[model samples]
Target: MTASAGVLDELDGIRWRERGSCAADPDGGWFEDLRAPAARRARSICAGCPVRRKCLAAALLYGEEFGIWGGLDSDQRHPLDEALRHGEPLGRVVDCALRADRAA
Candidate 1:
């Protein structure tokens, strides 16, 4: 198992239960839609998310292979996911993603 797997296991339930921008929405499933406008719509919601960092961290920690995360679509999340899988520290992954977000 990846180093993050165990840490992720212990944190998953609690982390997710913490409020996220989309959690209370009636359309929580929107984040998983891969279509063009749907991904865009989901990102809009994520953009204002108070828990965005936590959400992105969880996605990387667990290697989520689909959907929008932290206002980032699959393409945007790929590098962070790869870094996590390769044992990169979560702080470093988060820092990189934040930098990329600023540059975008």
Candidate 2:
């Protein structure tokens, strides 16, 4: 299998949601809202999440078209998702997006 496919396969077994900081957030609305303030809050919560990369990978794999994942809104993740769809390594794309998120 290709490296990106393998990465996605590995991601399948991980219980990332159990480890995510958002798991404890009772107000899950922040993640689903497209408003700037809510999106920012969701991203902030994701910024400190241990499973952020996995979350992002899953979002890309599933073609999630809305909300925030891995500290990035749909628009932010679109380019990375496209790169992955175009056969980019999942690890490379995820890591780059995370690094950019950190730098921002």
- Quick one: best lDDT, which candidate? 2
TM-score each candidate. 0.71, 0.82
User: Which residue window of length 10 is worst by lDDT in model 2?
Assistant: 26-35
Using TM-score, give the best candidate's number: 2
Model 1 is weakest, by summed lDDT over 10 consecutive residues, at 26-35
Clashing residue pair totals per candidate (backbone < 3 A): 0, 0
**Root-mean-square deviation per candidate:** 3.8, 2.2
Candidate 1, residue 89: lDDT: 90
- What lDDT does model 1 reach? 0.72
Model 1, 1-104: lDDT tens per residue? 87667657645785563678787774654555576676667777877787787777777766777777777767888877778779889867887887678677
Candidate 2: RMSD to truth = 2.2
